[model samples]
Target: MSSRRSGISEEEINELISKLQSLLPETRRRGSGRASASKLLKETCKYIQSLHQEVDDLSDRLSDLMSTMDNGSAQAEIVRSLLRSS
Candidate 1:
């Protein structure tokens, strides 16, 4: 997709909105009615905490990969400089 808002056709947005609206009611019903609000909140909080940790782990891995790339680029530049000096 182009990096322009104008490039986003209405049909695509309507399709996405339709899918989201269809899913929302089912997801909302998961903790409704017989379930106590407190219990539902506690479960949701725990699930979000777990997801947060997973995201943190992935962020750390991405940081390591970026650092490795930066180091490799520096090494390549040094090699190129040495070659030019010779």
Candidate 2:
């Protein structure tokens, strides 16, 4: 039940690989052709990186929107004070 690669059983390795493959949508699309663990790991790294970038982009956009809204409210308050004095 031991594999030469790492003294781990084949079943254990296959179970781990299946878990990894399930995380990847592209791998599921390949249908019958299996991806090596190395490729799957690489794809996972890229997928994680893309998600990280997306989160950063969204956060920046949200901050920008909040800043704009704050400024707009301040301007409105300034105009109200001016109208009251006149």
Candidate 3:
């Protein structure tokens, strides 16, 4: 598949991978690094999950606000029409 079709450029993917790798805990000894890396990965996963929830919440709130605005606009138009008739 081409990068254009994939919706993500190669550079962006690589950059994201690099960022995830950087989140891994660093150690001088290779044998003891696994525990730290695992813990860091878990933390990163939790953070990402929280971010997803936040985005969902924001989206819902924005939808509600837009709906409210539309209703208000319709009500205002009705009021204006009633005034003009009177």
Cα lDDT tens digits for candidate 1, 25-59 = 43356533333445545655676788899999987
Residue pairs with colliding backbones in model 2 are none
Note the residue pairs that clash in candidate 1: none
Using lDDT as the measure, what is the rank order of every candidate, best first?
A: 2, 3, 1
TM-score: which candidate is best?
2
Q: What is the TM-score of each predicted model, taking all chains together?
A: 0.41, 0.64, 0.44
- Model 3 residue 6 CA deviation in Å: 23
Question: Which whole-number lDDT from 0 to 100 does residue 82 have in model 1?
Answer: 68
Better of 1 and 2 by lDDT: 2
Ranked candidates, highest TM-score first? 2, 3, 1
lDDT by candidate, in order shown: 0.59, 0.79, 0.64
lDDT of prediction 1 = 0.59
Residues 7-47, candidate 2, lDDT per residue (tens digit)? 88888888898888887778888875778889888999998
lDDT of 2: 0.79
